[model samples]
Target: MQENLPRKAACIGGGVIGAGWVARLLLAGVDVSVFDPAPDAERVVREVLANAEHATARLISAPLPPQGTLSFASSIEAAVEGADFIQESVPERLDLKRRILGAIDAAAPADALIGSSTSGLLPTDLQAEMSHPGRLFVAHPFNPVYLLPLVELVAGGRTAPESMERAVALYGAIGMKPVVIRREIEAFVGDRLLEALWREALWLVNDDVATTEEIDDIIRYSFGLRWAQMGLFETYRIAGGEPGMRHFLAQFGPALKWPWTKLMDVPDLDDAFIEKIASQSDEQAQGRGVRTLERIRDDNLVGIIRALAAEQGGKGWGAGALLREHEARLRAAAEPAPAGEPLRLMEGEVDAAWIDYNGHMTESRYLQVFGETTDALLARIGAGADYVAGGRSFYTVETHIRHLSETKQGEAFHTTTQILGTDAKRIRVMHRFHGGDGTLRATAEQMLLHVDMGAGRASRATPEVLEAIAAIAGPQRALPIPPEAGRGISDLR
Candidate 1:
């Protein structure tokens, strides 16, 4: 997980994988230049990017970086020109890939890192024609690339060790889990695993043992769920009971020698067999187009990732951990308050979960936002996680909130905080909540006591904290206090 993003990137092809690369790069705030000769290249990229944006917005809660600019160049040279990073996602033909990579190497800067989106081709072969072969490496990613976080980074004979290091940082910075392959091999790890299962699946269908739908259901309902979280060996370890993995493996390992799978053979894809598979696949779809099915896949992926992120006391599990870490990075990378403005530290849309039966933003969420705003203020005054870890922090003692407007689900909103006053032992603050259109929606005023966690009582804050508080308090004192600052429920009536 790195925080530094590539300043500029180039996509050598704009097909599904190429467009996916563009979406991920642009969302991470890197300017992208793409080149694809297909007549529908721009349209394809736009549609894919739109889907990426929609799915990503629902997947994360942290403030996203402003989207970077996207451009399509007429030639490979034009696309790679001055790019700090370049990804080649052209069709899987060796000659085509070699030519494209060679052209990119000729045009891109000497220090630029180049990655190939080849699924099975060897990186050594792909970089054969390149003038700067040391910069090229395989960066294989799964389909719907913007959502899937796994990207295998495989180095070739000529690839520099530093190139692998840079590849991990660049891809990890964009929220990807870059697993470096220890040795270069065709199809790599993930695809090789899939190929074995796929071979067996074809045999099952060819022999009329099961329909495609049944095969899919079996995996999705059983090991698929397990693999999504715990993975294979860990999932099997649970099956071992009190004895653990050794017992499980001893019982099942010998079964691997049984003639239960056709892993060594592939079903003949003759005309009839092809039609049988296609017809069954069509029946499984039941009439959904490619894009509809794509959205469905994206939505399901988002749900799983988010659920994983919420597991283990919110530290996240598996891919969810990656999402959580990425969210933290995004929050930390958020631009600070412009010099004189009230600290605009938090803003987000009303999530569906935040809505009430009345179809409006619920009251609890109002307090939640205010609570988060106070957290932001505390962090500004040098009382963040580390400060609290040292056994002291500000504790909110009283709060008064007045909701003046109704906000429905999906309505964008922001909050601004001002320090009304502060002392060695106490602080007073107010937060104004507004809609995206700048309409004031609500107000909250809070009083906090600086406390020593070890003592569980009021205590003077550190001199450094007091100085930080004074700096903001001194400037905010000139602004008139909000009318609802200290009001009670009766005063509103």
Candidate 2:
């Protein structure tokens, strides 16, 4: 994964996929320009970003990294100029892709990488009309880009090997696993495999062997669980046990020639099949809207990723490299102390899982509470994902917490943050936690350092952030450090 690199990117075609690409790129701190002829492109992009921000904030265990500025271009030429990378997410029509590439090639610099979000089209076919086809390739990402980490990178006939490498590096830097397709091929690897399974699934439903929902259940309840941590080959390897690879293949190979599927034949989009699938899917979805479903999906994905990551180790455990990149990003976005009055109040809750055997909140859960409280204060002071993407960040350097009243599970809590002091490189903050009854439950004091994410070290805060802190601090109350917290801070110091 690339670390602390900044690049300007342009997204061509502001549809669902295009907007998803914009959200992911901007959240990763890349300055993005978007262009689409649709009248509502700007509004659509804004809504997509908003949804992404909510999902991202909840999905991540750590605080989200800074986000980049978003700009809209009236023309394709204006969007591609000076961009380090261009993501093409226009309509799937081959002619439309050809025209867009032609325009981008004419405007963008020779060295800039251009990637298509095409699902099944060959990159070579898409780049046929480009003047500099070597710079063009496929960067197919799954839906809801902010949640899914997989990005398939495919190099076309004229695409340079270096371009592919750069693309991998670029996507990897942003916490995505960029699997490279060695040669130009239709549908690429993941999609082709999915298509194969989808064909069999359709046949099963069409032949009354199973209903659509039943087929889905079979995959989700069985293979999906195994696929989450270990992929197909590895899962089968484990299943074979002492028999090993050859023995495993021998057992399964015989079933391949059976009349199990019509893999070569395309299912006719007949009215009956379409209606059956549509009604079943709609029934399964129920009355929930698209946004609601998207949120649920994103939350599930986050839970799975977190479980995998934690199981592996502290960092890079399950997903390894990609998860590490995400950790680095979170570390870069920790809270910093504000200036002036410094005290800010924010509300939160003690999660049910944070309770221990006694049914009260555990000791470590207090730290998490204070941590979230600090995040809220920072977010209020404009220290959010967008802030970090601009090459500025905050890191916690010191912390002190005092336990007072023991809070039980399901109790609501509130935190008040106070800025103690500030300098060019560091700021001090104090927090007090109150239980549902407004009784002080705990107190915490911390010191944070401004950081330059690119340099991977302490650095001075930008004037904008400093000024925001100053504004918030000006009218706030003094740091009312509780007596217990004062002693705790003294001991820690």
Model 1 per-residue lDDT tens digits across residues 1-493:
4355888999989999999999999988899999999999999999999888877876765667898899999999999888999999999999999998988999999999999999899999988998899999999999889999999999999999999999999999999999999999999999999999999999999999999999999999999999999988899999999899999989999999998988888988999999999999999999999778887888789889978987874568999989877776776787866544577766766767678999999899899889867766776678876798899989999999999999987677888988888878999988999987999999999999999989889999999999988877887777888788778888554
RMSD values for the candidates in order, in angstroms, are: 3.5, 9.8
Consecutive 10-residue window with the lowest summed lDDT within model 1: 336-345
TM-score of each: 0.86, 0.72
Where model 1 places Cα greater than 4 Å from the true spot, the runs are 1-3, 241-243, 348-403, 419-433, 442-480, 487-493
Please tell me which predicted candidate would have the highest TM-score against the true structure: 1
Clashes of 1: 0
lDDT per residue for candidate 2 within 405-433, as digits (tens), equals 89886466666677766777776777888
| Number of the top-ranking candidate, with lDDT as the measure | 1
Query: What TM-score does prediction 1 earn?
Result: 0.86
